[model samples]
Target: MPRETLFTKIVAREIPADIVYEDDLCLAFRDIAPQAPTHVLVVPKEPVESIDSLTADHQELAGHMMLVCKKVAAAEGLSAGYRVVINNGKDGGQSVDHLHFHVLGGKSLKWPPG
Candidate 1:
């Protein structure tokens, strides 16, 4: 079983979030600490621990998440461009255990982000 993280709570409606989008497979909400003018976190409703926990069976879920990110970006009016980032672990700057994609845009983002 996957460990329940803060994201899981949000998905379960046990915690409140500035939700931007939601579907049967996933949910998207605004990040509490915005990195850019627009920062959103797209996560699967089914907890998956982290990127390291992904398996071949998750192939379709992974692709679907990316599509959700794109949809969110467009809804946010990020026609200029946007960045989709998934941090895997502690060293990778993953503060949360649940796998999630960060959609950041609305401003010029610096390259080689730490």
Candidate 2:
């Protein structure tokens, strides 16, 4: 388990989220602001500040996040292709402190990603 984080509140059902997939370790939900036709935010139940904070001990959790992203994407009919993104620090465009992977697809995405 991790220290208190916004994601912890969301996972604890303290805040509402349009959840798509969920297990003991993570949760996938629709993004409030969709960058693509299909956009979902996959977050770990544990409190990881950002990708930069992941340590060797978090390898399994990292792998699990990828696996869940694939599963969620497939379930959402994104077999053709999809983009998985993890924004790092402020320079990387991280808004929330909680670590999350954005799964985007359901349409052709352009380069640069804006």
Candidate 3:
């Protein structure tokens, strides 16, 4: 219905990504314009614009994303701690239209997040 986002390109392998994790449910890869030392994006294979577009059928999908984030974060040696962020819309600072979660760690993260 709309033009594909950069993330969509990654999903289709039209663009290269430093993929950290992937499964039938979703895909996880390093952010090109990384905000933190350890910045990764976990995105669902089935396109959803944002969390606002999530429906009842997406509940399990959402949970799976979190579990994957957790496993990947630990694997990345961010066992100390990490932040999982979802920027839902333009005002929420979502640069990409695809629904994805940012996992940031490897340094102290100050709150009142920017």
Candidate 4:
């Protein structure tokens, strides 16, 4: 079985989070440390370790995550624009082991983010 992760706790409602959107497939919430005015983490209910852990069966789930990002961004009033980021591994800046999408917007984002 996959190891439990912080995101799994959030999904199970064991850990409190400022949730912004939720559905049967995924859930989205505010980031503890906001990198932008509108920064949210969209995570799947399934505990996939990271992007590196995705399989063919997760294709629909992955696509659903992107759609969740669009919906969350629009709901957050990021009409100007938004950025969807997925950190693949430790070097890619993925803190939580679960796969998630970071929806960032509310201002002009610079290119070549660190």
The best candidate in terms of lDDT:
1
Query: For model 4, which pairs clash?
Result: none
What's each prediction's TM-score?
0.98, 0.93, 0.96, 0.98
lDDT (10s digit) by residue, model 3, range 1-114: 546888889999999999999999999999998888999999999888899989999999999999999988998999889999999889999888889999999999999897
| TM-score: the better of candidates 1 and 2 | 1
The TM-score of predicted model 4 comes to: 0.98
What lDDT score goes with residue 26 in model 4? 98
Task: Locate the minimum summed-lDDT window of 10 residues in model 1.
Answer: 1-10
Give per-residue CA lDDT, model 1, range 1-114, as digits (tens). Answer: 877789999999999999999999999999999999999999999899888999999999999999999999999999999999999899999999899999999999999998
Model 1: what TM-score?
0.98
Q: Which tens-of-lDDT digit does each residue in 2-68 have in candidate 2? A: 5676678889999898999999999999998899999999999888988989999999999999999
What is the Å distance of residue 92 in model 3 from its true position?
Answer: 0.4
> What local distance difference test score does each model get?
0.96, 0.92, 0.93, 0.95
Supply the TM-score for candidate 3.
Answer: 0.96
lDDT of 3 at 82: 96
lDDT ranking, best first: 1, 4, 3, 2
lDDT of model 3, residue 108: 90
